[model samples]
Target: MKIHVWNAFASNNSGSYTIVGRFPSEELAAQVAAELSEVLAAHEQWFRSPTAPRSGEGSRRETPSPLRAFAQVHSLTQGESDWADQGELRAWSTGHQVFLHDPCTLSLPDSYEEFLRVRGGKVETRIRHAHADIVSLFELRGTLPKKTKAETVRALVEELHADDGPLVTLAPFNLQPAWREGSKPGEPVLTVGAVFHDRDLATGFTAVEGLARRHGLDVTVRVSEEQDSRDSLAWLRPSHPPLKRKMFDVWLLEAGYSPKEVARRLGELRHGRYVDVPGLLKALPDTVLKRLTLSRAEQAVRFLREGGANAELRPAE
Candidate 1:
C-alpha cells in the first residue's frame, strides 16, 4: 500500500529553516503554516505598541527593519516527492522566537526591563528595542504520584465534566535517559498533557488542584499572570485522537478498493500504523469490514459505494 506524508518548514528569519512537523495531509500542514504567519503579524503589532522607544529617546530607531517569514510544504512518497511554497509574510521586527518557559525554573519577563534581565547579562543593563514574550497559553505535563493514580485523575476529571473541556492526555515517557545518567532505573513515566488557553486558566487550575488534593495525587498545578505554556507541549498534538472511541464498522458487500487502496485511504484517516486490510478481509467470515468513527465510516462508505460496491455501517455493540 502506498502512503503519503507532508512536512511543513518555516524560516523565522532565524537565518535557516526549521521543520515544524510532519502531517498526514497537505491541508493540515498548510493550516499550521498559516497560523505561524499570523503569529508573526501579531508579534509585529506588539512591537509597535506604545511601549516602544520614541525618536531620539535612546539608541533605538523609531522603527526596526521588517521581519520576513516563509513556509513551505513537501509531499513525500516512497521514492519521489514534490515541494510547494506556501508563501511568506513581513512584520515589524527583524527577530522572532518562540519559547516555552518553566515557571518554577525561570519567571518570564513582563516588561522591557525584565526582558533584558532574562535575555541579557552584565555590561548590558538595557537595550534599544522594546521586546516581550506574550504568554500564549498554559500547559500541564507531569507524572502522577502512582501508576494507578491516572484512573483517579480521569474519574475526577470526568466527574467535573472536564473531559470535553481542555484537551487531556496521559502518555508514557521513556526514562532511559535518566537511567543512563544514573538518575534512576528505567521506568514508565506517565505524563499528563493538558492545554488550557489563557481565558480558561481558572477552570483548569481548579480542576487539576481539586483532583490532586482530593485523591492525594502528587501532581502540582500552577498559573501565571501572562500567557504561559511550554514548547514541548506542542508535541502532544496529533492529527487523530490518541485513544480510540466507540466506532462504526464499515462493510463492503462487493469489491470496493483493492485491499491495497483500502489500506492507503484508511491510513490517511486513522493517522496510525498501516492496517493489514487483505489479511483482515480474508480472516473475517463474511463481508469486508473496517472500524472507523461515524464520520470516517461514512466517508469510507461513500468512496466504496462510488466504486460500485455496496457499503454500510454497523454500529458497534
Candidate 2:
C-alpha cells in the first residue's frame, strides 16, 4: 500500500484535486501533508487577494483558512499505484524554467503541453522564454494574524507586481498530475492562480518584508543554493540522462566545487546526483562529538571535521 498527500484548489465556484506526494509509509505522508496544510492555512489569504473590490457582501468576515488550496492524507491500494509507472525519467538541468504542473484552480489558461512520452522522456515540462509561464514563489515558513493576513498579502502582491505578478511562496510539496497526457488536461491547470509556478524562479524573492512598512507578517523565504539537485531529486526515481558536473556552468566551478570530481562521482550514485556538503550539514544533528575514527572512504568527512575542530557529528545510520 502507498500513502498519498492529496491537494485541492478552489476559486470562482470551481476547483480540482491531485496527488502531491506518494510515500511508502503513512508517517512521512502524514508529515508532508500536515506541513502543507499548515503552510496553506498560514498563507491562503495571499492567494485570495481581491483582483478588485467586491461590492455589497455584508461585512467581510475572515473565512476558514485554505480559501484557495487544501491538502489531506489519502490512502491507495497497490492497484491504484499504476500511475507512477506511466512516466519516463528526465534529468533536471538548470538554466531553464521547468513547469511540472500547475495545480492552481485559479491560474490563466495554460500555454504548454500536458503529457509524458516513454522514450522521449518529456515527463517534465520546462520552458525557456522568460514570460511564457514563469512565476516568482516565496514559501512562507511561519504563521500570520488572520485579521491582517489578507492586507499583508495584498501589500506584498502590489509590491511585487512589475508586469506579471507578485512572488508568492506556498507549500513546498509538488503536486503530481491527476492524470497525464492521453488523458484530458485536468481542470486544475485550466485557470491561473493569483501566483503559481511549479518550479522556483531563476531569481530570488527575499526582499518582500522591506516592501511594506507596517504589517508584521512573519514570512521567511528560503531560496535553495543548489537548484539543480533540488529540481532533479524532487521526484522519487532515477534520471534518464544522468546529470553531470559539466552540465553546470562555470560559476559553480569558480565557487570551489570540483567539476571533474563532480562529473566523476555523479555517475557513481544510484541517481547520478550529488548532495553537497551544506545540504548534508543541514540534515546532521546539533550534538557535538569528541573523537571519532574515520575510514579512507570518509576522507571528505575527515576534511570537513578538521575545519570546525568542534563541529558536531551524528552517528552514521
Candidate 3:
C-alpha cells in the first residue's frame, strides 16, 4: 500500500491539491484506499479521490510554495462530517480504474473548486509556485489469501482457471483501517481485509499487469472484504455479455502469458490474439446494440478485429 500526494490541483481543473497511488492488484488498491480514509480520519479535511479532477487553472496556476492544504482548513464543507454520503466519499470503479468522485458534483472540478474556494482562492489565480503537499509511492505487495481476491489465487499454480475480470475493487472505507508500518511516508499503513464484489477486478488487474510486463516490472498477486457496491453496481452488469475474457485471464496465464501479463492487458476473450483497445478510453464503442454515449473505443477495436479476420479475402493495402 502506498500514497502519492501532490500539493496542487488535480485533473478536470478541480482543486489545487491531491494524493494518489496505483497498484498492480485491486485487493492492494482497496487496502491502500481504506488506509487513506484512516489518514483522512486522523487529519481532518483530508479527502481521497479515486479519480482527481483537473487543476492548474484559475488562481491555482502558481504552486503553493509551502504545502499546507492538508493542514489548513479548505472549506466549511470539509468541516461537515458526512462520511456515509455516497457523494462525499464515493468511490466509483469503472472499466479498469476505481475513481473516487462526489455524487453531488456534476464533475470532479466542482468538488475541487469548492475546496479551493474554501481554502482561500482559486489555483489559476495564484501567481507563484506554491509548496505542494505531494507524495508518490510505488510498492509491490505480493499475492493474497492464496485465493484471497482471486477466487483461486492459491489454486492458480501459475495457470489461469477462473473467469474473473482483471480488476476487482473493495471499499476498505466500508471497513475499518488496520495498519502496519505504513508503506508511504506520513501515511498510515493499511490493507483491505474484508470481502467485496470483484467488480472489474479482471479488467483493472490485467490492465495494470500488462503495463508492468511491457515495462519488465516484476510482480505477482497476493490477495478481502464486504461492502456496499452501489457506486459500481451498474458496471458489474456490463452492457456486453460479461465478456469471457474474465474466463480467459486464468487460462491465458497458464497457456503462456505471465500472471503479470494476464493481470496487465487484454485482447478479445474469444480470440487467442484479439484486438486491444486503448484502455485510456474506457467506454464501449458505438454500435447498433447500445449507444450510451458517443465513444469510439470499443467500436474501433471491433473494426480492427473483424477487419483483420477478413483481411485474407481482401487485396493487400
Candidate 4:
C-alpha cells in the first residue's frame, strides 16, 4: 500500500486528529474507517485532554463517543482500554487548509486540489495526531487506488470531544433528531422538567448534577415537587433559538418572502417570528391576523395547534 501525508492545522486536538481517505467506493471508505479503528488505536501515541470535562464544561458529541463511533470500541469502564485515537475523520476533505511556509505561494490547497484533480486514484486514508503541542495534521491530499480496512484508533477519543464546563452533560446515548443541535450558536435552551415519581427535588438535582460532573455540560435537571404538574421549566442557554422563531422563518419562506426579506422583517419586529401559536396570534393585531390564512400559519409552525398546553414560561436562574 502506498501512503502520503499532509498537515491539517484546523483540528489540532486529539478528537480532531483523524484518519480519512477517499476509497474507490464510499461504502468501502466507510468500512475502512470502521475497520482501522482498532489498528489506528494501536498506532496512536500521545497524551491529550482527559475525557472528563474541565471544572465546568459540557459534552460534545458530533458523532457518538469513540467506542460507539468505531468498531471493537473499548473504554476505561470497559476492557481493552489500551486503544488509542486522535480525532474525527471526514470521508470528504473539509476544503479548509492553510500553508505557512516559504514556497507556500503556489503550494496551497487550491494548487493541491488542482494536483489531486489530475490523479485518477479512487481511494485514500489519513492518520492524525492528538498531541496539542503539535500544530500540524497528517493528511492525504489525493485519492486511493482502492479501499483497505484496518482497526485500532482509540484513546481519550470521546473525552477529547467532550465539552469543557461545570454543568452536567446529558446527551442521549443515541442522539435523537433533537432541536438542540441545529439551533444557532449560543442559542438559549429551556430546561424543562417532568414528574418523576414522588420525587424529592434533591434526587433529581443530585442525579443531574452527577451527570453534569460526569459529562461537563450546562444542562439543568428539574423534577417538579408538584405531582403531575407541567409548570416546571427553566431557561438555560441565552440567545437560544426559540422553536417559534424557526417556525416563523420557515413559514415566511413558504409565504414567498425571500430569506433576506424575512430576516429583515423579523429583526424590525424584534424577532416577531419567535412565538408559539397563541403568542403569535396574540401579538398580531386582528386586522393583520385576519389577512394571514390559518393554513399559511400552520404550515410555518408545524406545532401550531388550535388549542393545547405549551411549556410553562419559567424564569431562568
Instruction: Pick the lDDT winner.
Output: 1
Better of 1 and 4 by lDDT: 1
How much lDDT does each candidate structure score? 0.35, 0.27, 0.27, 0.25
The TM-scores, one per candidate, come to 0.27, 0.17, 0.21, 0.18
Candidate 1: which stretches are off by over 4 Å?
Answer: 1-245, 248-291, 312-317
As for model 4, its CA RMSD to the true structure in angstroms is 24.4
Please provide, for model 2 over 216-291, each residue's C-alpha lDDT reduced to its tens digit, 9 standing for 90 to 100: 4322222222232233223323321221111110111121244344333322321222345454345344321111
- By the lDDT metric, which is better: model 2 or model 4? 2
Q: What is candidate 3's lDDT per residue for 159-261, written digit by digit as tens?
A: 2112221222211112211112223443312121211223323333444455334333333322211124332223222221122222110111121223223
Which lDDT tens digits does candidate 1 get at residues 1-317? 99999999973321111111233343443444354456445545645667644344545444431221121111111110011111222111100121122211112112222221232211121111212211122222234555554565455434332323223211111100000001133322223434333223334444544454465433322212322323434443431113335545666554454656655554443333356776646654343334345665677678766554556788743
Tens-digit lDDT track of model 4 for 51-145: 42222245443433333333324211322222223232112222221111110011111222222223322213322232211112111122212
Counting clashing residue pairs in each candidate, in order, gives 2, 10, 80, 44
Clashing residue pairs, backbone N/CA/C < 3 A, model 1: 135-227, 137-228
Cα error of candidate 1 at position 140, Å: 5.5
CA deviation > 4 Å runs, candidate 3: 1-35, 39-99, 102-162, 167-215, 218-317
